[model samples]
Target: MLEHNDEIRRVKISVRPLVEYVYSSGDIESGFRSVAALHEGTRIHQQVQRMYQEGDLKEVTLKTEMLYADILYQIEGRCDGLILLEDGWMVDEIKSTSSDICFMEEGYPVHWAQAQIYAYIVAKEQGLSQMKIQLTYIQVVSGEVKKFVKSVTFSELESFVWGILASYNPFASLRLDHIRRRDDSIRSMPFPFDSYREGQRKLAGAVYQTVKEGQKLFVKAPTGIGKTVSTLFPSVKAIGEGLLQQLFYLTARTTTRTAAEHALGMMQSKGLHLQAVTLTAKEKICFQEKVSCKKEDCPFADGYYDRINVGIMDMLSNETLMDRTVIEHYARKHQLCPFEFSLDAAYAADAVICDYNYVFDPRVSLKRLFEERKKKTVLLVDEAHNLVDRGREIFSATLGKAEFLELQRGYKGKNNRIHETSRVVNQYFITLKKECGEIKRKLWKELPEELINKLDLFVQEAEQELQGIGHGDAESRQLLLNTYFAAQHMIRISKLYDERYVTYAEVVRNGVSIRMFCMDPSFLLAQAGKGFRSTIFFSATLSPLQYYRDMLGAGEDDYSLSVASPFHREQLDVRIEPLSTRYRDRESTKGSLVRLLSKMVRERQGNYLIFFPSYQYLQDVYDHFSAENSDLATIVQGTGMTEEEREAFLASFRSDNPDTLVGFAVLGGIFSEGIDLQGDRLNGVAVVGVGLPQLGMERDLMKDYFNHIGKNGYDYAYVYPGMNKVQQAGGRLIRSEHDTGILMLVDDRFLQRQYQELLPEEWKE
Candidate 1:
């Protein structure tokens, strides 16, 4: 929807990010700042706009084009109100704040700057020699209003607008140059691979055509068909053709993010000049041992905005690929928070590789992506099978009574308001526990209005405390902050709750817990993906296409493609052990399962990965197998392995190893999918049991909910998800055409009609 002109080298930007960037100064905000909820803010805006005069225009769409530094800038925005003043036109900008407006004698520079831009645009277009600008501030809770007005000549307005443009021109120019050269390279570049491996061309063509038409494409691509490149290549071509300005390669796991980065690297080596940024989670990339955003506590958070533009310019000018290492280098060089720096850099990147949370999670999604940019953006969701569960997590939230109880005690003598609010919340939990009596666990179709009201009050008190009314110790402060975030998240999710959601309460050892569980996330996912030009959800394990389509919010007009496996069927030697590895039979069959794994490894004489349904099962069999074999080389996956430990585990599976190496892992784990160990590095894989999820309240709720909606509830909640993991684990073997490996499916369920039908075509006889 942006007015982009390739010939004119025009840069289209919204009014907000531009002004914020130009006026951005000082430190990254400290941990606690009062941010009104989105809906609350919108309500306040409408409340103010309702007072407009008969001739005054509210939500006025204003736009103007300016030539600055020989680059065209198409700036557009909706002004809060264009007042019909007695003297002339007055451009109004409304801002809602939690703080009192009485102390704010004048308005913020950023607010004034925004009003001035709208005024200038209106003045230039209407042939007015003068214009009035107004800053309307309303205190959110009290509904108190404060207004500041200024009048400037048309020449003065023009000068001010030009200065704003000049400050932003450098960034726009940098992006413009990158796009020009990137497109040039893309126009001449061929596919990165030597040739399309069977289904690759079809997938690539489908992606390109889907993007061109601005629709969604769901793909069930088999493993080893170059799914990454097949998707990325066509998206890159779309960028070259001006069909898209940016693409987000969203993955469910860190390993898959690496795959996307590697795919882009492959294209870059072939002269593709696109600028791509890989965003690592903040916890993994922060320079400090403990992440404290307080300016005094962390050097990187101090005056980050002051140095960020320079850092971004330096990185973009010198490097085309801004991965973690490159980002950290520039971040340290410029004294910037690496995570924040990457986000800033990503705004200008042609492609962004990051986790699905960054794009889909409401609490974490980037707010700076304006509607215009979104209309030109595409989301390529990788390993999409993981998104079903991830989507549920994204739209759900939990609140525990323990945090409130702790806060109630911590703040009792220090602050009465926080103490009282926390006590009230804790007391509500106690009463809810009494209501449950013996059952302990309860579910409801409606929201808990009373708890929500109490949590809202607690959130307000907590926010005031965090704003420095009364200070607490570091530990107390952390607990309060964590509780504040949880309360806010719960409130946010409550707003999204509908018939597809359920409210559940469970009593724990010490206290009670409640969660707003999103039983089906299809509606929310569809809402989140609305503005994008196109979305391509592809995974090697996105089997049972219709099930995924319904769960992933597929539209009626959306296209679905099921690409056949590019690898030959003869390459895989499949076998069914026909053993009982179910939960009830696990102890009875542990010995037989151990022997089967030992025999497979001994027979193959190459590296083999054995996957179990859970860590306990993996350990049980590993203990028995080790007791019998003793001399066999083995490594077992530990719980919560660090990145270095994981690397060491995989590195042990080198192709040059002299003897056979067997790795014990769990299905649907970090090792099960998104890993590539082609050729001699991995020669066999054995998946024990049908990878069914542990039976739980949430899964049962999902099954019941889906069945109520006239679908196979058990399959929707259990069977399909379990089999997806089996497919993903088996997929690790035979990554390429030349690769050959043995696949062993342990458990009698593998031979069952239901499970057999769920297996991938290549895995079936």
Candidate 2:
């Protein structure tokens, strides 16, 4: 006979009554909630810090529970910090609130119950028979302190804990039921799609085989191949096969997350049962603008673990795809900290659809997933090429002397330790600035390891002081938080710090210092790629597969696939006019370029997009073309266009009784890739120049670097990137089998063998 699982056994007795009885709970928007509390807290804290002296404050440690377990049976329910106290054993829970705290009385049963749990744990840990537990509430505004205390024996505390547990059992039972069903569903689930495309099949087979064999596969499938579903479907099947347990669908942008969600929805519709979650960015998803994770500032963050287990159980049992809306609904229903709850839920999920940062970024990788990495996990990287740039930003750290100088001034008179640390960091930057000799930019062949080491020591001291404080002291807290993030960033980048990265310090102004830096992300990306069982990097414009594969760190053993465009070659009228539009030739060809654009618009009856190499070029053509054919409706790209404006720009193109709608946009900008202008809505694309990035120091350095590596320096630094932009822009013209459009290359470079060889077979003439 099969016995109940450990989770089932735990939930049976732990479910509490209060959670058991609630029905049709109101949904609290976590993002808004966090933002509100952050705003209020930041405002109040700023005022308090301005008026208060750091030396006047005393550090307090209110010992509550040594081991506190949630009444909910989830594995994440256990927490060590029950209740914290300031000096005089005054239990303090600092809360930042956007609303009145008058409704929360001193002896509220729930509040006391929570405090009692903490007290019980603290007493047991300290071997005390009785203790006075104080509930100190700090009003976010006015900095008012309200203290409530009650003396209770260990027996009373035990009774109170038991009561809370009894109130929580039903919700636990509901969760267990869902988990059992979800696991069962996953065990029996089949391939969701009725039939897979050829590219989808090949990619899926490779992913599954890789997971089974415990190796890596690098795939380059083109667009329209349903890469998301292809990758997800197999990972789900792997779950059923007991070869893998979790899948992380990582992407570069928020827009891509929806596609992952949609793919999961498709699987769910086919009777496949699994938990899939999309993690919104902390800043964007958080209800509060300035997020401080302590309970006193935000109720959602308060006693977060107490209700988290029930929240997780509730969500997993009822929903398959825990997208933002669904997660928010359940979080509100159970009064769980939505952000933390989402993270916890992700740990238990079968599939996690999130940004690449969640998995690859050292500063933000999910801690819980570390255990799942080896057993059964596969990473499906969408738009893998974007990882090249994204990885650099993630692995790079920047620090300014001005920030440390400001901090030194803020703490100089009172905190010797903080002041000394800040001074040390400030002086280092000063010395670095002096060495640069008034030049804003200077590169070091090697990283300044000694400087980094000294910074690390300072970070260690700051962290130690921060840990000692426990809670409160707004000014010190902010300083510590800033330093902590800085330290974390440095620590993350330190691992990848090498000769490939240029370490340069710049002087912004007198007494103001900054560091300009760059790290070769390829090696770091390769490190991230190693943890996954396999990765499929598919895009419409990965024309030069070797370039992408090399930069993405694909090994020789990794499989590569290139699918030919499904659309007929004849459908697109590809024409390359050998007319120079280079930077030097622009002035001479200005008239011809405008004439060419005007001619394309006149010849094309419907929607058309003309991509320029730079914003200046785009504006120049827009001005000339508008002056020549002012009557034609046109939208030119600006530095920043709101979502509504972008929608309006695309909406101007109509399929019925077509009128010429010309849009001028920079290559590789917002209008490129991800925007779908299927069929008649878009009929043609005219690309100007070679789309090379401006000739600058960075480009020159990259060229030199590649030259040393025995590769084509110009191609690596300029031509490849330019062509990538061109290919992506050209991809917009053909989206489907029936879609017919015209593609005109306005630059003479495309006619050259070097550039022409880089073109896709379908575009080669």
Candidate 3:
């Protein structure tokens, strides 16, 4: 399917990536990752810019393109600042560093390359004979500033630009060739599926239009509608039409990520030759048992940068569906770090299948991804309802007193810096604990800047200790790594702290811990997608669309669609059993719930799933059910089931499954939602209780916070979210029109008008 054309297409690449690919050279090693560990000087940049005179521009945008042997290279970028000089104009390149200014005396070759390209572009456009290029390095730790200037004639700038282009041209030409072939296949490839079934066509159409219009769309296309392909196919078609350059199918769970990979594989088999790369988590994807990045520990990590480019080129040239296995194959082949290799391959990929955190998380989101690419990229957020809670978790940060106390004790006398910094942080918690002795819990409307400042000092020391990690044992390095990430996370979260965030500290019997909790993740979630071309938030049950719209920060102009269930309501035999399943009544009603579940499964002999609000409640009911109905084959969901165990569990359900199995699963857990069991494999689903979350401080805080903002606090904090889990569990049944099943709503609250209003159109009584 991947065939070369006689002529190559123009590949649009910005200056950052261009210079990085051409001029940068090093082994693939992580730098001191802590944002505060270095003097990034975001504040200093603005402060320095203020000193510039009028007519001098800060953040100047520049563009230039050149054609080389059959390849058109489009290069554009924004310079940090452009100053007006008496002779002409000066290209100001600002860089923040943590090291001493003396090391920066000659300036980095990459920095010079970047500045020279800007100089060349400006000189060529303004018809100038010469230009002054200045490199300003701001030391983040000391706030010390160093400036270097170089004067070059137009001919000198042109020669330097040409030399870099010669190095970059091969990579560009390779990509250009691939794009031409990829576009041809995309333009000619027919719909992979024989046809769209049910409301699949409608879902696909809405997604295509949304991407074309450059807007966000919230789609409520239920399960069994082929949601993955329905969204992917149209987006792939858009790429062929030259409306898009890349697509990111962001998923929340591994099951859904696999589903995306399978969808792309299906298309590829049908003649689609697009490069779709899947990013597995670093910890899981690592080839080593432990992630020790030292050269002595890992061969793949040692010379990663030395081999990564060749690995990327080889992998991209051959593979279309670059899933974890494919990525690992090439990673091992080239002796490159598998995780970092996947990230590099991802930037070059036409489509990326990765987790939501890669795009939205504040601490770990890909930093090198520029806004220009985002302008041509579309985000397909699969199982979007999960993003609400997941977003809350991603944006939240908690620090326990025990971690710092442990570090203080462990590092004492050995590393004075780590010990002193840890002791200071530990002392801060000790003082705060006395103030809250009576309640043991305190809340703050503002972020604790003093604590953050202390953590910043701690991170600085932690990074230093970690640089000598190989000198210590694995445990020591692991401890240092954990604390470093924690401190860095706290710093990152502090920067994003606004009115939507609340800081809380609670002292338990064991230890004291403080948290910066995101009461509403809407603003931060919206902020994460600041530059993306468009986003499509789709799931089988995005019920109460308004709640999702409000919480996901959907604009008024954004599109929303509610596709009718393709299957007839007749296929689902719905029942509303009025019984008390609230936490208060769960104890007394446990036996009755077991009997009801037994009765429902006894009436029909096929696979069934019974969902409860909590695992303890589920276990209690499961214990009673097993006592009474031991004859039926049964499986109970466990806590944190591994990938193999989960697959074997799902594999237990099949069309040829001999027994009428009754699987007891907790609501909102893995099996309760994402997994599918179509046709005779699944016969019924009984969702016990109203699915309200356990009453906790965090939930209460969210409730009170929402109430203060004139919204329905209880519903926002508990009811709707709980019911979303209930609906997802129920949705597992009646996946296809041919599949007939019974759906029983076991909670008395379900019959209430307020709760009934939240039910799906087909499920409501």
Q: Which predicted model would earn the best lDDT?
A: 1
- The candidate 1 region of ten consecutive residues with least summed lDDT is 1-10
For model 3, the superposed segments whose C-alpha errors exceed 4 Å read 1-8, 36-39, 46-58, 81-92, 102-105, 122-134, 146-156, 463-477
Positional deviation of 571 in candidate 3, in angstroms? 2.0
**Which parts of model 1 have CA positions greater than 4 angstroms off?**
1-7
Backbone clash pairs in model 2 (N, Cα, C under 3 Å; residues 3+ apart or in different chains), count: 27
Candidate maximizing TM-score = 1
Better of 1 and 2 by lDDT: 1
**Which 10-residue span in candidate 3 carries the lowest summed lDDT?**
1-10
**What TM-score, over all chains together, does every model reach?**
0.98, 0.75, 0.93
Candidate RMSDs in Å, in order, are 1.6, 10.3, 2.9
Question: What is the Å distance of residue 433 in model 1 from its true position?
Answer: 1.1
Ranking by lDDT: 1, 3, 2
Per-residue accuracy of model 3 over 534-632 as CA lDDT, tens digit each? 999998778799889988989999999988888888899999889898777888988888888889998977889998888898888888899999899
Q: Give me the runs in candidate 2 sitting further than 4 Å from their true place.
A: 1-195, 289-296, 464-480, 508-519, 642-658
